[model samples]
Target chain A: MANHAISACAPDASIESYIRHYAQCIDISLKQALASSNAHPKLLEAMEYSLMAGGKRLRPILMIAAAESLGAELERIMPVACAVEMIHSYSLVHDDLPAMDDDDYRRGKLTNHKVYGEAMAILAGDGLLTHAFYMATLAAGSDAVSLQRLMLVIREMAALAGIAGMVAGQAADMEGEQGITSLEQLESIHLRKTGDLIVFALRAGGRLSGASEAQLKALESYGYGIGLAFQIQDDILDITGDPAKTGKAANSDERAGKVTYPYFLGMDESRRKMHELTESAKQAVQQAGLPDPQRLLQLADYLMQRDR
Target chain B: MANHAISACAPDASIESYIRHYAQCIDISLKQALASSNAHPKLLEAMEYSLMAGGKRLRPILMIAAAESLGAELERIMPVACAVEMIHSYSLVHDDLPAMDDDDYRRGKLTNHKVYGEAMAILAGDGLLTHAFYMATLAAGSDAVSLQRLMLVIREMAALAGIAGMVAGQAADMEGEQGITSLEQLESIHLRKTGDLIVFALRAGGRLSGASEAQLKALESYGYGIGLAFQIQDDILDITGDPAKTGKAANSDERAGKVTYPYFLGMDESRRKMHELTESAKQAVQQAGLPDPQRLLQLADYLMQRDR
Candidate 1:
C-alpha cells in the first residue's frame, strides 16, 4: 500500500523545476527552524548569516529528489532535508574559520568569522551542528516514515558525518596541508570528507522512502559516482572557472599549494574522470528502477556542466 | 509487569559504591566506543586525551543512578549515559579552545588544542559531538526502551545540549566576559549552561525507565536544584579550593574577571545558596516515588561538600 501510493506520486515536474521547488521548500523550513531561536540574537545572526546565504541547496535537494523519485512525499522528509543543509552550512562555517581554511569570504560574501568574530562564529557552527540532530529527529513525527527508520537515519547520519567519516576526512585534509601530494591520498580524503555525507543523504532518503534493497544499492552507487564527480568539478572550477561564477577566488587551490584532482590527475584526465563518474551516476539512477529517475539524471548532468 | 520487576531490583548498595560501580561501567563503555574508531589516530588521540584525563563522570553517573534508583536496568541506559558524557567532554574541549576560554589546561592536563593543535582539536570536538547522537541512537536496539521512546530521548537531549541550551549559555557567558555582572544574569547563564543538560540526563533516565509523570516532574525539580548547587559549589571551589586537588587553577575565574555567584552574593552567601540548593535537590528526590532514592540524596549531599 505504501509503495503503491509512493509510486503514484512520483515527481512529474521537470528536473529544474523539481530542484527549484524543493529548494524553496527547504529554504522555508530552514528559515522557520532558525526563526524560533531568539535566545542569543548575535549567535542566531551569525548562524543565519551563513545558513541564509545563497547557495544551490544541493544536499537537501539531493535528499528530496532521491526520496521523491521513489514516489515518497517530499513534505514528509523536509526536516531531514533541512538537517543536512544545516550540517553542510555548519561544516562550511567551521572550515572557513581562522584555525582552518582561514577564508574571509564564502558564497560571494564575508565568511562567518569575518562577520561575527571567531568565538561567535565557532558557537554559531556548534549551534547549527547540534540543532541539526533536533531537526532530523523531527522527521519521526511524519506519517511517511516510521520511528525505527528515523532512528536508523539518525545513527547513519551521525556515523557518516562524525569521527570515522567527514571529520576523519577533514583531519586528514588539514594534516595533508603540510604537503602530501599523492592522488590516492587526496581521493581517500575526498571520499570521507565529501562523499560520505552526500551518500548518506541519498541513502537516508531511500531508507525513509522504503526503497527496495536493489534500489538502495543503486542509490549508493549513484551517490559515490556523483560525489567524486562533484569534487573533480570543484577542483576544475578552482583552476579554470571565473571567480564571479564560482563565488570564490579562482586559482586559490594552486595559491594555497593544496592538492587537487586537476593537479594530481592533470586537467584532461580530471575532466575525463568527471565525465565517467557522471555517466556512472546517470546509469545507476537508470538501473535503480525508480518511478521517475529524470531529476537525479539531470542533476548529475547539471553538476558536471556547472562552472561553479 | 515491568514496574514490578524494576522495583524488585532496586539498588541496595551505598551511594559511594553505587557511583563507583556505575562510573567504572560508564568508563568501560566510553573506552570501547573510542577503541572501535581507527580513523585519524591523532584526532582520536586528542579526543581520548580529554575524555580519559578524568574527572568524575558526573553526567553519565547521574543518568545511571537515576535509572537504577527506579530499579531500571543500568545496562539498558548505558548508551544514553555515555552519550551525555561525550557531549560534556566535547563541550569542555571547545570551551578550552584559544578562541573561547583560552584555557591552557583542563583536568590538570594540556587542553586538546594545546596538545593536538587548534584545527585537530576543533575536529576532535566536532567528532565527539557528532558521535554522541550515534551513541544515543544505539539505545533504540534495547528491548527495555522502545524506538519511539529512544527517538524522544534523542530529540530532548539534542535540544537541551544544543543551541537553545548549552550553546546559548556558552555564548552568553562568552559575551558576559566583557563585564556583565549580575546575580540574575549569572543564574540565567548557569541555568541554561549547566542546568539543562543535567536535567536532561535525569529526565532521559526516567523516561527510559518508564517513570510515572509525577516521578519525572520530581526528577526535573531535583535536577534543577542539584544543577544550580553544582555550579555554585564550582564557583566556591574556584575561589577557595586548592589547585592541586581541583585540577584547575584556583581563583582563575576571579583573575579572568568572569562573574560568579560569589562575586555577586559574597562567599558566605554563595555557600548559603549552595546549601539551600542541595537541600532542595534532596527534598525533591525524596518526594519522588522512586524505588530507592537514597543514592540521589547522597549524591546531592556529596556534590555540595566536594572540594573538586
Candidate 2:
C-alpha cells in the first residue's frame, strides 16, 4: 500500500498524473537519502518503514509544484521537497506513539510503533526529523541554490516545524482536549499545526526559486487557505470517508473526542468553509503572476474535492 | 546543581577559569536563542525546564573552543555552539523517557519526562532538536562566515548529529542491552554515539574558521581519541564516583547489566586507555599549528580529570 498510489483521484486524470509524476520523483529521492544515511540497519528499517508508508505526498508535491511554477529546476529543489515529507512522516510516526494519539493503523497498515516497538519507533521519528535537515542541507551543496536562500529555507523549516509551528499545534491540540470551546480556538490550533508546514512548503519552494517578496507573501496566503480547507475536509472525511478508502477507522476523531471543524461548525458549515477557502487559495495563486500557476490552481481544486 | 558549577574542577586553576569563562558565554547564548523562539508558554516552559537544567555544557564549549582556537569570531560561531548543546539536550530528554532509559534524574534534577510528562517531554525534545538547526543556519546570516563554509558546517552537523552519527549510536546502545559485548564492539558503539558529535563539533568549528584539510583531519583525530576516553571515564565513574558529585546512581551501568570499557578491560586498563587518549588528543592539537591551542589542550586535560 505504501508503495502504490496514495490518493483517490478527483476525476481529473491530468492532475492525477501530475501528482503521480512528482510523487514518484519524491519517493526516489527519499529512498536515496535514506540509503546514504549509513545508520544502524534496524534503525534504517524502522525509518524506511514509516517514511515509505505513503499517503497523499501532499507536502512534497506542493513544494515541488511551487518551485517548478517559479522556474526552479526539479533536481535543485527536490531535496527540500522530500525533506518536507520526511518532517510530515516523522510527526505522524510520533503522533501514533502510545503517549500521543495511540493509533494502531495508518494508511491501512500498522503504525511505526506497532511494527517497530516503542523505543525504535521513537528513534525512527527522531531519525527522520534529524535527517530531514540533512536532506535540506544537501540543497546547499548545489551551486544553483544560494547559501543565503538555502539558509532561509532551513530556518523556515526549523521555525515552522519546531515549537513555534507544528509542535505548538500538537501541544495546543492536546491541551485543548481539556476544553475545546469554539471554532476560533480549533482554527488557531490548526493554523500553527497544519497551516505552518504548508506555508513552509510553499514559501520554501518559492524562496528557493528566488521568488520576489510579493510572490512569497502570495504563496503564504494560498498555503493558509488550502491548509485550513484540507484540515476541514479531513474532519469531514472522518465522519463520511470509507475505512477502506481513507485507511482509517470511521469517525475515529469523534471516537477520540477530538475537536474538529465539523465538531464546531457542523458538517454543512464545514463543507461551505472548505469550499470558500479552496476558492480563495486558487485565487491567490492565479493572481500571483507566476509563470506556471496552473498546477497549483488545480491542486487547490483537487484538494477541495478529494475523498480520502 | 544544574545552575551552579557542573564540573568538579581539575587541579589547575587556569584550565578551570578558561572553562568557566567559555561556559558562561555558552549559557548566555543558549538563553538568548531560546528566548527568541516565541513558542507556546507551556511548551516554552517544558523546553526551558530541560534546557536550563544544565550539565557541563561540554559540547558547546568544545565547539566554541575549537572555533576560537582557529581565530573564528565567537559571535559568528556562538549560535552553532548553542545549537550543538540543544541537540545534546534533546538526546538526553528523549533518552530519559519511560520508553527509552526510563530515568528519573539527570544532573541531580528531575528528568524532563518526570517533570513534563511523556508527551510534552517528547515534544520538548523535538522542539530542541528542530531549533538546533535553526540556530546553526543562523550562522549563514552573518557576513563573517561565508555561505560555503557555513553550508559545510550545516552538512557536517546533519551528517554527524543525525542518523549517521548520534542517532546510530543511540540505536546501537539500546540494542546492545540484549547481550554483553566485546571491548571493540563497545568502543564502536560509543564512538558513533559520543565520538561522532565530538568530531562534528571540532570539524564544524574548523570548517567555519577556514581550517585546512589537514587541520580538520587533526581535529577529527583529536575528537576520536577524547570521545572514547570520555566514555571510558563515564563507565569508570559509574563504579567509583560519588552519587552526590556525579548526579547519577552508583554502578547504574552494572545494575543494568550494560557493557562498558571497564567491563571488558578492567578498571586499571580503562584508566590507562583514558590517559593515553587524552595525551593523544593533546598531541593532535599541539601539532595542528593552531594559532591558539592553549584552550583546547587544557580542555583535553580538563575532560580527562572531570568527576561529573
Candidate 3:
C-alpha cells in the first residue's frame, strides 16, 4: 500500500505527466478552498503563500500511486491526493512558524509569516489543516467505507500533528535546539514530527482504494523505510547539497546545531544508512507485487536525489 | 438534546445540583484531555491554567438544557458539553495571546503566557481545540444522523472560530479594540465571537435528540435573543459584577476600550435591552410549549439576573 514500486518504467508514462495531473487537481481544489476563506484577506494571503509554494508534490504523488495500484479512477483518487498535500503543506507552515522552526524562507520564497505576518501565518496554517478534513469528506460521497477511511485518516493525521506527533516532536526539537541529542532521541523526535504524516499519507491512500491487507502491510513497510530514509537524505543534504537547489540557507541545520542523522551517525555512516533505507523501501515495494512499481521506485530514488 | 431541566425550586433536580453536575462533567473531562499534553510540561500547565480557571459553565449548561429539552439521558450528553467548553476555552487562550488581546491576567490569576510563556500557550490552545472534535466524535456514536448533526455543529463552530466566525469576530474585535463605535458594531462583534457557539450548543443539543422542526425553530428563536442578551449582560457585568465571580478585573472590557454593548448602548439602555431580550427569549420558549420549558425559561431569567 505504501511501498515503493519496482516495475520497469512504463514506456509512455513520464513523471511530468504524473506531476502535472497531481498539481492541477490539487492547485484547483486548494485555491477554491483558499478562496472560501477570502473574507479574511490576511489569512487567505498567508495560506496562498504556503499552499501554492513549489514542491515535488511528493505526498500527493504517493497517494495517486497507491490509488493507481488499486485501479482506482482519476476522479475517485484526486481528492485524497489533494487532501494529503493539504495536510503536508499545513505541517510545513506551522513547523516554520516563529515559535517553531522560524525559518524566514522556504523553497526560495519568503516564508508565510515573512510574507503575511505572524498572526495571519498562524491562522493560515490552522485554516489549511482544518480544511483538509473538510476536503476529505467530499471523497467519502456515498461510500460508507470511504467515509470511515477518510475519518480514520483525518483522526490519525490530527494525532500526528497535535501533541502526540508534531508538537511533541517540536517540544523535543526546541529543547534540543541548544545542542546535539542522543541518536535514539533524535530518531524518536523525527519519527513523529516529520515521519508520521508521510507514513499516514501512504497508508491512507491505500485505505482509500481498499487495498488488500497484504498489500497494505507492504505499503506500511515501504512507508516506514522511505520516511526514515527521507529524513536521512534531508540530514545529508543540509550539510552537503547545493543550497540553490534546496532553497534554504547552506549549512543551516549545522549552524543551528540541529541533531540530525548525520550529526549522530556522522556523514559517512548516515549516507550509507540513507541508501540502505531507500533500498529497503524499494524491496518492500517489489515484494508487494504492485502491478506497476516504477514510479514508486523512482520516487525513492528522487528522495535521495533531492538537494532540499 | 442539550437543554437541562433545572428546578431551583423543586425536587428531581435543583439549580445547585444541575450546575454542579454539569460543571463537574466539564471539569473532569477537560482535566483528562489536558493531562494528555503532560508530555510537554509547560503546555500541560498552560492548558490547565485557562481550562481549570473558574468561570460559570454557561455553554455546557446551555448544551445540557437543550439536551434535556429533547429528552436525552444525562450521561450520554456529557461529552458534548465538555467538547463545547473546550472550544470556548481554546478561543479564550488564543484571544489572550500577545498577538491577539495581550492580556496579562484572567480570573485574577496570571494569563496562560504569564504562567507558561507564549509558544506553549499557543500550542496548548491548538491542542485543546483540535482535541475537541475527537471528543465530539466519541459522543456522536455510530448514528449517521447523529454524526452528521455533530459534524454540522462542529463545522459551524470551526467556521465561527476560524476566519469566518470567532476569528473574524476577534479580528473585528482587535480592530475595534482601540476605536470607538456605535451599539450596532458592538452587538455584531459579540454575536459572532460569543453568540455563535452558544447558539450551536443549544441547537445542537436539541438536534442531537431529534427535536421537532417546530421545536428547533423555537429553540433558534430562544437562542437568538438570549445569545445577544448574554453578551450584553457580559458587557454590563464588566462594569458592575463582582470581580471574583466574573474571574476578570472589574471594568476590564472598558479598560481595554473594547467597545462593548454597555459602552455603545450606554448603561441604562444596555440593561433595559438585556431584560427585553431575556423576556423575548423566555416568551419564545414559552410559545414553543415543550414538555419542559422550565429550564429554558429559568435560564433566560438567570442570564439576565446574574450580576456576576
Q: Each model's C-alpha lDDT?
A: 0.84, 0.85, 0.70
lDDT of 3: 0.70
Q: Per-residue alpha-carbon lDDT of model 2 for A1-308, expressed as tens digits?
A: 12332232233459979888767777877887788778889999999998998867899889877887797766667778878999999999998899888889888889998998899999999999998998887776435347778888999999999989999999887778789898899999989989999999999999988899889999999999999999998899889998777777889888888888888889999999999999988888888889988789889989888888
Residue-level lDDT of model 3, residues A261-295, one tens digit each, is 87778899998988898999899878886776677
Cα error, residue A245 of model 3, in Å, equals 1.6
**lDDT tens digits, residues A205-264, model 1?**
888998887988898899889999999999999989998889778899888888889887
lDDT of 3 at B282: 87
Where model 3 places Cα greater than 4 Å from the true spot, the runs are A1-12, A37-39, A74-83, A212-217, A288-294, B1-11, B34-42, B74-77, B178-180, B212-218, B286-291
Alpha-carbon RMSD, candidate 1: 3.8
Docking class of 1: medium
Which candidate, 1 or 3, would have the higher TM-score against the true structure?
Answer: 1
Q: lDDT: which is higher, 1 or 3?
A: 1
* lDDT: worst 10-residue window of model 2 chain B: B1-10
Q: On residues B127-195, what C-alpha lDDT tens digit does candidate 1 reach at each position?
A: 989988988988775332467678888988889998889999999988888877678988988888889
After the best TM-score superposition of candidate 3, give how far the Cα of residue A153 lies from its true spot, in angstroms: 2.7
Model 3 misses residue A46 by how many Å?
A: 2.9
